[model samples]
Target: MLENLKKEFLQPLEEFTPIPFWFWNDYLTEEELDRQMLAFKEKGVDGFVIHPRLGLPEEIGYLTDTYFHYVRYAVKRASQLHMKVVLYDEAMYPSGSCHGQVVRENPAFASRGLRMSARESAEEGELLIAAVKREGKTWYFWEGPSGGTIRGVHYGEDDGEAGAPASADLMNPEAVALFLQLTHERYYQELKEYFGNTIIGIFTDEPNILGRCSKEGMIAWSGNFLEDFYRQGGNEQDLYLLFADTDSSEGRRAGERYKRAVYERMSRAYYRQIADWCAAHGVAMTGHPEKSTDIGYLQHFTIPCQDIVWRYVAPEEEKAITGEHSTMGKCSSDSARHRGKRRNGNECFGCCGAPEDPYRFTMEDMKWYLDWLFVRGVNMIFPHAFYYSLRDRRKEERPPEVGMHSSFWEDYHIASDYIKRMCGLLTDSVNQAKAAVLCRSEKLSWEIAKPLFENQIEFNYLEEELLPSCRIENGCVLIRQQRYPVVITDGKDTPETRDFLRRLEESGGTVLVWNAALTAQKIREAVKPAETFLPPARDLRCTCLRKEGTEFLFLVNEGENSVTTNLRLEDGHICQIWDAWNGTIKQLELPVQEMKLSLGQRESLILVTDRGE
Candidate 1:
């Protein structure tokens, strides 16, 4: 079994290839498209996302017949090459506007938001959000919609802001339906034959409620948001609390209710609608939401996804381990695991270099980002881009293009093969985690996560929404074949979540409230990990997985410095070191109770052992 697994891991399937976003950013000719496709295929990358980006001349308008002609040619060529294609469902990012066609056709569908003012001035056709008197001052909240600004995709002179295009109201189901009619339906019409075969899925980039460039202090709203909120048991008085930052219990609860309502409405209006369309058409809906911790919306995705862009995480940065974005890798992966999905994806390495030195992106930095995602259980990778043309200003749209125009394009196969092997290994394996950290749909406990990573504790983030459906079995929380003997919490739980935790505790499960008093030693006592480190390497991260009858321990040095430690395992197990980078395996001597392990900065290693009977 080990030998067979080794053989399989060495030569991964094409499905595991890094499907980079092929930015169609210039006057694309069939000859140039075929040449770039051939180059990618030669470099071991068997798939690409046809991302329509900036720099295309007005002659080739978005979603025009000419655009479809080129897209059809690329899809046909991909089929001939036996390569997969994922259609990006937008001209440029923040999808759902159909490149402003949705709002252009119906100006009423433009993005809307709620604004509060002390003076009441009723404008014609303006929708009133709320009316509340706080501290004897009457506050009038009304819709303040804004969009349809024709700022093309380029870096703004002021603070390098990438101006957003006209965005439709994603909170409105009618607007979303129009978007699908213009974008997704057109793709299905053009490439109906390749729905589930050559063309695997459609990518919907982040679609927010109000979208980018919305007015400050305005909450995302739609024409019928108040009606839906009322239908969902929301009070009109609570609407005022959303505009204020008061810490009163009533205000806090009201804020949570409003945000929850917004998330639910957007999920039903936008994500669910798109997901159903894809499912009916035999394609998968794959994309991330606006926020990283928006796991509530991710449940609707066939291929749950999140993105790491603009240096949200880096090699030696604390952001990599202790930020809201850091949880995104696990956010998608855990959502997939709970939903019984095979793969989760991340769109990574976009604008990851320093702003002062955008071209300073290195192969080592790429490797670190890859390991960060793979170790967290993400199996599919969408490399930020492979630009078709880097002519003129197109090169600066999103800096540090890691594809055909990169400094390492000659040896691109090296990175491609590494991606394939790591993705292949993580795809079908069962994550062997004995603990779960409870989190809300929009909130993750980074305070708890930081300590857990430092202590080498392997766990998954379990959303509170999923707790009721989970079965409590013999002092363990079981759901979708994942069992957790211990559940950790950051102590900021909602009433419903607290009730669920109480039930779990009553069922013989260990509930650890994350606080300053709760140390790593206490966590070790509760989880009692299968493997232990001699001196507890703080910056070393590990994920344990099982495939066939073998166990694999993937370890990464997330810190800038080197780490040396002795790993101790059970006496009956046999260990081997599998090098994913070079596809090599080294057997260990018998009686391997304890072995010394050393890893350099941003380096990773895999320890394979037998599942002893």
Candidate 2:
């Protein structure tokens, strides 16, 4: 089995070839489309997501007769070329709105937001009375009194900003249902023949409530928010405290609870329902949410994915509030592993640098980015964009076309092949992490995760939803066949969370908490202090995976400088370095316990060993 695995890993695995985001805007001829598809095939790309984007001429309108005609031709050509086609579910996105068509028809389905303002007299009869505590004085709202009122209002075409139209109300089921019917179901109806075959999945972009906000005080709201809030056991009186400045603990808890309920409803309406639809239609739902690093939001995805390009921390930004580039990728991959999903993807290389004056990323930068994600267990890649036309003004649509127009277009196969080989080894293997790090929140997890990532300590981020299903025994917590020896959590603990911790402790698993003290006796990691190491260079990140009783350790250097480090293995095991690039396996030239290894800049190594030698 080990020998076969090694051979397979070394071979050119076609399925590992990435799917680039093919932007179909201009009216493309059949010949040109066929030529591009063949070009991708010859360049070692196995698939593409047909993304309808801006700059499309009015004649070739979105979701019209011409559009569906082009779709059929594209899918048919893809079938002939032996490449998969993923359906991008919107024209331009934050998805769910069907490019404002949902609201254009049904004006009531427009996205909504909540605002709290000081009003001398509430002219609108619908406004709810709100309370304000200012300078130790409590003020109550009235029709002509000196307090504030909370109003639920609609966001117009640009979501009250300067851009495209507002998104559909993701928290509202009717709006999301209309979006699916217009976008997803339309594709399904037209491409039924290719459903279970070449049409691999539907890619939905970041669908969120409360459109991008400029002010800190903005809150998400829906038409039925008040009714839903009360129905879901939320306190009506505490709604005012959410928007007000209050340092009280009860107020904070109330606000957190309210936001969580909103998130739950949004997740249900958008993610769960879409997932169920995909399952019934014999296809996979493969896309991402707005807050991609929050692993809980990825639970409903069939293939589980995240976008790592525009928003993730860059290499130069070391002290960034977010972790390194691989942070979001790891979150998606970890969630997939825990949930028994075989594949996880990333929408990579989209709007990489600063929004203003975005830099055109070089081939070298692309390699490092690809390696960062692949090392962290991401198996599938969506290379942000491939423009339909770089002609005229269309060239500046998203800029930085890493496709045919780029300098490295002719040599893209080298990068693609390399990624394919790495992915082949990474997938179909069980992750051998010893710890399950719980993400209390995406921000907190980002701060806490770096220590474990940088020190070659392998762990998976356990989401809030997965806590109940886990079982602990013999100093290990078992979730789906993987055993986590330690469980680390960040932030405040609840009675429910505390109970879970106590149960883990009682079952003999080590529990570690950050910042807060729990009733359960465990290790408290207040801050991620500097880690002390034997050889001293802690830039190499590692992951352990198992296949047929043989264990493998994948170590990758996240830094630009090379470092020689010492690796220690279990007492009874022998380590053999599987040189992935060269496709050769050789034993470490030392005792079975410890070995010194040299790693180059951005280098990765796969070490294989028997379970007990």
Candidate 3:
């Protein structure tokens, strides 16, 4: 198994190549496209997502014959280059608008939201969604009958910036179906021959039901949301409670119910429908949703993904280890793991540089992000983008192009080779984790995760909803092909989850509730660390995986300081170090129980071992 791994590592397949989003932000010509693609090929990039961006010429027109002609040419060129293509579903995103065509063609399909207004001062055209009397005052919630209620005021006209493309109502299945007709179906009609072949999948950028620029207090809503909410056992009165600013238990419960209903409806109406379409067409539904913690919607993606753009995470920063976006890497990877999917992706490195100097993105910054994702079990790489043109204001649209025109373009193959090699190793291996951290669809317990990471206690985020289907065995929770000896939570447990934990604890499995006093010592006592480090290196992160009886341990120094530690390996294990950057394997002759290890700041190492030395 070790020999096979070494061979595969040395010659990682093209499928593992970093697939960048190729921004077609200009009046593209076939000759220029061919030249740029050849340049990418030379740098070990074998795949690209053809992303149409802000500067695309109006004459070409999104989803028009002129656009199809260019898309077809690119797909054909990729095929000739023995490369792969991922079709970007939107002309610009958040994806569902199809470049504003959906809302423009059917104004009723425009994004909607609920707003609270005084009964006497309500606008003339306002359709009352619901009415509730509280404190001797009658509150009117208006935005048509189906609009969902939430607390906030200040509805913006479009999804993103003021002039950004209008977004479609994702909670409405009819609108989503129309979006597919205008986008996905149109692509299929033009490129049917490339589906599942040269064209591997469709990339749906973050889709939000309420336009990003919607009124400040507006909650995502659609025509059928009320009916769906009712069908899901939600009370009509609770809708009013959702808009209440009270910290009462009823208000909290109402908010939770409303959010869950919205998530479920949108997941069914949008993501699942797209997944089904991709399945039938022999392709994959890739890309992410609006929020990083939207794990529930990830189940519908064939190559479940999350984005790490906009400086959400940076090297040596607290943001890298805590917060909601920090959980994104595991959000996609763990979802794919539990679902039996072999690969998961991250659309990384967009605007990750310092805000003051956005163009200062460097090779070091790029490698840091790659290591961060790879160590988290992510196997697919979608480098934020390679630009088709940087002419005029195109370069300013999303500053700091990471490919083709970057300072490191001449030496890019080094990063490309590193990406392919790491992705190759992570792809088919089974993650060896002993603990599961319980999380919700839209929430993750990053506080619990922080101590675990610092302690080298590898864990996967287990969605609380999946608890009932998991099997509790002899001191272990079994789900699909993975097993966890202990489960931890943030103390925010539902009745069902509480009952499940009770059953698990009764079966000799460990269960922990996260709190202010929870420490690394406490976690180490409850869960066995995947790899033990002498002197306890807090900045050293480790991910262990098993591939055909051999353990592959990827260790990353995510901090600024160098880490010197001794690894305690099991007896009878034969150890070897694989340098991913240079594709070199070296045998290490060490004591059966211990091996010396040293990692520089921001450096990573891979240790492959098998029993019976």
Candidate 4:
């Protein structure tokens, strides 16, 4: 068993690496199904996500007897081929509505939101109005007035202008319960025999509260929000203030607190409930949250994930402008590392090429994306999709099939092997970070995070929820195996964080109060910089992880030109390079304290050692 485990660890495509064949049930046929799974196995793919998506014919019928029959065939074939099966919870994505089937049965269960629109009233009369909140701004409306009330309710609808199927209210427990019964429970009932064995877990897509929320002015609402807010120590009158544009400090504070309460209630109603359900059913819940940069909410996922969309640009450009979309991988990875999760996932390679230049995603672009993910500690790969049929319209649905039909299909295993090799090293390894920055808010945290990323200062974003588990020990904030000698507090300090800083200071740890321009002088003052790794020039990213007394240092070149770098270590040290290009681990003997290395454009390298080796 030990030898077998070791052998599996060395070559983990089947069990450890999860580039699951996304079996889009478009034109379901037993022969075609078997062929796809076997084809995936040939490409070193070892798992499949049974996704029933658009273009699936009406005759097959989603979640029907025919659907189950196809599902059984796929799962059974995977079992025979020694591959894993992960169930996609919904027929179409942005889950929770069960493809609008859930809300269609009961319109009351459909998602709801508060909308604020203004129109001129012909009658000149004084009217009492209630204020409503929309995207952090307040809008006012007359109470029960006719013709043109500024504040009116809007039912949940698709992002498109045309009326479509309504999204289920995730904040409503009843609506979520119905969703589970109609979708999740149905999967378990049909696939119970393989739940924990061949069937590994279920992937729940982002079940956002308001699907494709309006950009103009909209706020989410639930049937039980008012009472729940009051019960949770929120003022009933202050709720309206949350929707109002107030300049007073007290009013602004009240609005922030009330909005936070609403968010907490939604999380409890949706994520906590889904997590509990998955735990009970002997499966892991793996999926991204609606807003991936909301780090605190990531704790609810069993295998925290984020979706990487659009094009694969340089990391530096992504950091400068992309905001939440780009930094999602780091957010999920930090959340997972803090909670000791072994695997973090990403739904990547979607729309890599622009719509006009479809099927133009080169293998090099995929490599760059993979490097970005791995550097941030994302180990699991959900390669966006794999088509069950490239026939007719199914060919056009989420086109540029990166799987069996792509131009590089014959050489898919080359990329597959590299991903698995890197992921195998990342999994079960302890993160080696010496500092953490308080993730006060997304904007401020990213502001401070920019300098940290550019300088290659490895750290994690410490959320307030992780504070209780952290403590100052020997002049450092200690949590499990991770330690931070310096903790940077950015923006307005919260009372909780202020208290934490005081405790940390009293315990002889250092804290850097963030200024507008977070200069290197401030960072240098907080903690003396080390010389473990340095490049001739900047724009290189590196991260460290330790497992079983061996430390792994991963480095990537983020620039266009080849560069030479020196890895500083103890004199006469021995280091082994995990060369992805050659697929070999070659030993390195260092004569001096710094070892020089030359990396090509868009290239990366990993070094393994145990102090002197």
lDDT of 3 by residue, 337-364 (tens): 8888889999998888766798789888
TM-score of 1: 0.96
Highest lDDT scorer: 1
Model 2 misplaced regions, further than 4 Å: 120-163, 212-217, 231-233, 319-326, 353-359, 441-444, 515-533, 572-575, 581-593
Could you give candidate 1's per-residue lDDT for residues 1-613 as a string of tens digits?
7677898678877889999999888898999999999999999999999988778776788888999999999999999999999999887868888877888898888888888888789554467667888778889988857532333333331122544467888888999999999999999999999999999999988886776665677778888778776765668677777777558888887777788788888988999999999999998899899888988889899999999998888765688788898899999999999988889999999999865698778888899899989989999999998988889988887878999889989988989988998998898788989999998889887778888888888899999899878998888999997999999988888798888778888989899988789998899898998888878898889998887777898999888899999888743464788888887888877737678889998789998876565
Better of 1 and 3 by TM-score: 1
Question: Is candidate 2 or 3 superior in lDDT?
Answer: 3
Candidate 2 per-residue lDDT over residues 419-461, each given as its tens digit: 7877777778887777777764343376566656655566777
User: What is the Cα-based lDDT of residue 216 in candidate 3?
Assistant: 68
Cα error of candidate 3 at position 295, Å: 0.6
Q: Model 1, 561: alpha-carbon shift in Å?
A: 1.5
Q: Give the TM-score of candidate 4.
A: 0.88
Model 3 residue 210 CA deviation (Å) reads 0.7
lDDT of 4 by residue, 281-400 (tens): 998888877665766667777888887766633444554224556577778788888887878889887766544676666677677778888887888888876777677756665555
Native-to-model Cα distance after best TM-score fit, residue 359 in candidate 3, in Å? 0.9
Q: What's the CA RMSD for each of the models?
A: 2.1, 5.3, 3.4, 5.3
**Model 4 residue pairs with clashes:** 133-243, 138-243, 609-613, 610-613
